[model samples]
Target chain A: MSTAEPPAVAPGATVAELGEEALIALITPMLPHAPGELVGSGDDCAVLALPDGCAALSTDVLVEGRHFRAHWSTGHDVGRRAAAQNLADAAAMGALPTALVVGLVMPPTTTVDWVRDFAAGLAAGCRECGAGVVGGDLSAGESLMVAVTVVGDLQGRAPVLRSGARPGDAVVHVGTLGRSAAGWALLEAGLAPRAETIARAAACLDAFRAPRPPLHAGPALAAAGASSMMDVSDSLLRDAGRIARASSVVLDLGEPEAVLGADVELLEEVAAVLPGTRPRELARWWVLTGGEDHGLLATVPQASLGSLPDGARVIGRVREASAQGPGVLVGGRSAGADLGWDHFG
Target chain B: MSTAEPPAVAPGATVAELGEEALIALITPMLPHAPGELVGSGDDCAVLALPDGCAALSTDVLVEGRHFRAHWSTGHDVGRRAAAQNLADAAAMGALPTALVVGLVMPPTTTVDWVRDFAAGLAAGCRECGAGVVGGDLSAGESLMVAVTVVGDLQGRAPVLRSGARPGDAVVHVGTLGRSAAGWALLEAGLAPRAETIARAAACLDAFRAPRPPLHAGPALAAAGASSMMDVSDSLLRDAGRIARASSVVLDLGEPEAVLGADVELLEEVAAVLPGTRPRELARWWVLTGGEDHGLLATVPQASLGSLPDGARVIGRVREASAQGPGVLVGGRSAGADLGWDHFG
Candidate 1:
């Protein structure tokens, strides 16, 4: 048999022109090598050494047009967003991220540059949490789609579950709130941020594209005695409600203005530029209902509040479940409505 | 706060009408429960207790029109095939399957019954390999897609890598080969099998729709001292070439006819009914180059040949790499050309 050289990759080659083998060769080196990896790519499966007996697993899927638009997001943005969401799920369970496996389906005409950038972002995102891209599969489809599955090691710690919250716990949040949804609104409204609001607007856009989840805070909170924990992905009220239902308790936001005033204040500058917006009310609504910033939400014993992780603020408190049932309440009253994102609703 | 009952699900409801929450409620119960699971569905992530220190990870993606046409295969068939392929990758690495996480993208119009059946098939496939569906994500898209990632425990055994093969090793294969491709050909040609070939044709079609990979044989071969191994998802020649290149050796098929004659004979009955088909020659070609049956292909020392797992048969021998470099040779001559599947090509 003759050993033939693979065709040189062109600058503007489509995936169909480059073929699967060459495309794989191009992307493989971009993946971060894990220190615990026993076997890497080129095998039927990647063998990884888990740090502990218990492992946490989560998956997330992003579809073109539905989750993103090509014109609005770069390939890097898509990849980073996809990785961030799934990794956040593991962090929500107080686990340290370890590895990720990707499933990508793209139109045959997709450019090689786009895929290369996507791989770079994926590797970068995983590297941030000490994880690596271990294995993946690729296919051709009518539209671009990315599905990522992340694995995490608990490091001998018990997984912090939402069902562990108690009536005397303090409700805490440890990352940005509402910035992503605000950025999306700005994009949809086609409004450019004024000179005074440029930094906040940019931060909003950045959060919308590739969020910096407080992954380190997860394990720290658990170590400090968090009663229950989860990442706020579907809006503060909805996610808190999830913990409430699971724990059979009520999460009561004691003082809306005091608890969320800073987040509301940050959005007022951008809201001022929108023609029909009521700045103060809109900013408050955004803080209460906007989602996708991937903030860590938790409940801790009142005695352990002093030992909570950095960037954490007391947003509310847990109360006994009444005849009204487990739910989220503001100032001892029911929160307005659940405005969380739903794929089909 | 008010405790409200969820709307009752009606017969033949679409995903859009049921919404994300209710749809998930319907599907989660159908997933198999793992014995080692520390946590299951409803949490941000599922926590699993692995049996060993190391785990094997693999992913596979199946696009609607690209991988399977809905008119030819049911949703149950798609789900089963998706789970089976990923699990087979783990088996090929000599790992026992532990858990699976699925990412599904579907159109809003998909029926609840289709999803319920699909979950059943996925659960059944994982159950066969002693695994459970631990977690998954769902989204809406224009076309249906299934992405599955499986985790397997190595049980403290060293993994069998493709780079471990050496000269004088016996090249062996176990399980069916080329049957899925033959079934695909039958579907493409619109040639129904004659009465005499009905049973064989039915087997071919079943293989195409839902491949039954021999899961238990992988660890068996490894325990018996296999040097290298992989599943035959691509054509035999293409996969053999991979092993050769990785191991830096040449796989020499000294007696192709005697090695694969039985598989060739099994295809001839169906071939006889196709117009313009050379039954014997075409069947031989299929046995040589067709793929997607998920059979195990391995190399072992000659002394261990007698200890090989059940259904395994020697098909070739490994030789030191020559100046021509690593490749596959049939009867001491170069195999004509590679015709394995390429996702984008």
Candidate 2:
């Protein structure tokens, strides 16, 4: 964990030099115009129209060192990653993301270009997810912190909640698993310094920098009658435990071979490049506990599994809670340890 | 400017010791349950029902050291202050605040009790402003920062924007001005350590620590047909300049005597307590440029001025923009220099 200072600003081109209003002016034009927004930025509040009369709201914070390293990611990557996580939360609720409000805290010495790139990346992420950046606040702080709150329109559909899973339901997942964890490991193992490793694990490194969650799959799963759903932000085992406890059911994740299936080969390839580690063991751990992928996990009736959305894999089944308590069981055994990111921990 | 470390944590009671879940469990019961909220905290996203189908959104960030000193403010005061600013923004839009989503960043060494008090203050603020703590995100950071996003319901009324003030409109304000600034100065002048000064300047200190914006006055003024409105978070002169430029009208602030009225004596009393400062001069500065009072400022036709909400005071008038350019003019002249708080500066 290097605590290196961020690169120095170019002479006289600091945030303080540009001033707050001017900085806002620089980023205002870059914001994508949100159609139907009654009010946008540069006002006391942004007025938005939610035709369905209901809104799904979620917020996430990304700290400079705790969430992303300046040396490992570009400003654009940070912005995109911040927006993606919040958007994924909206998706988890079976809603279409409509707008984002960002609160940015950075030092006065931060460069305008860095701020501009960060805004651009936020806009880009919003655009990618069919959303718009409607408003934001900027403040000077000791370090960079991006707090993003996303609003989504439910569009007349009932939100998919984590407590709705029933016994005998199939637990399915859409999007990559453990790739970000593998990428993070690669970067930590000096992969960024080696051209061969960087080239070989480019996708992994990119995943670690800016994740591309399967956002659309959320609404699709909802439409397909998902009984329960949540975004896999903390890790499969840990997140699945949330659903199990909330739904009062036991989630029995199938064997690793059945769960990983084709992805096993890719994980194995990623693991093979890392020195002093067993490829199969590392690949398995990464697949099950790797978080930050922002993938969608849902529980649906067995009958609906055949009609699941594209690329969704059926990896587990819901069972009646046992005396041992409601939680996730992998291959008929307890996971033994929680291998997820805990903020306080 | 005493960069003092926050008081040391009680032995073995750090956030890391309690863990994230335990801390969340400690605060969850303290959150106010917002009436009619489709969903509250403890979910991936909070689902809110906006019967009118429109929502006003706003966000603000408060950074440690930059925004407040831990030595000067309790965690609860910081939380209340953070929530008040965002809620005031919503009120400035002529909307009734309904919910808040907070993103809190703190160091890993922070105490669980500190976090608990912070959450309680947030809930208390929400309760005071007719809103609820819907959802939030927490992350570890180098410094403490509270990023609050408030959502409000318009209740079928059109938002009073800063751009709608017409010539001949009277600018009015509801709530105190300069009290927070005076309090900040008093604290800076070592008043906090002096029992006599603290006793005499309690109102000022409290205003600075936690502003109680006249939130109901926003919708009330809107109902009375306010043409333009905004919260006076920054200096009255600076914030007034925003409406002036947006409306393409000149804002002529009235004489200080008329604007300050009975508050003059109170301001003088506060100034009298500070050494080496002229009472009248400091009072004038505090009234014109002191920021963070979170007061509601609105513009309405002169004919409706008599029917303005309770505690509302007429402070200026809107006029056609002259060749000099649209902006705020105090006592027949430009403000001359920006004395407001500048985040970067």
Cα-based TM-score, every candidate: 0.95, 0.95
In Å, residue A247's CA in model 2 sits off its true spot by: 0.2
Tens digits of lDDT, candidate 2, A1-345: 001123344655889987887778778777775545899987898999998889999899999888888888888999889989999999999988889999999999888988888988888888876888888999999998999999988889999999999999999999888888888898788775662344447777777788888888888898889999999988998889888888889999997667878677777888888888999998889878889989898999988877788989999899999998888989999884367988878
Question: DockQ for all models, in order?
Answer: 0.85, 0.84
lDDT for each residue of candidate 2 in B247-335, tens digit (9 for 90 to 100) = 88999998665687877668778898888889998898899999999999899998887779999999988999999888888898887
Candidate 2: C-alpha lDDT: 0.85
Q: For model 2, name the residue pairs that clash.
A: none
Q: Which ten residues in a row have the lowest lDDT in candidate 1 chain B?
A: B1-10
- Scored by TM against the true chain B, the candidates give 0.93, 0.94
**Model 1 regions lying over 4 Å from their true place:** A1-8, A192-197, B1-8, B192-197, B254-257
Q: What is the overall TM-score of model 2 with all chains considered together?
A: 0.95
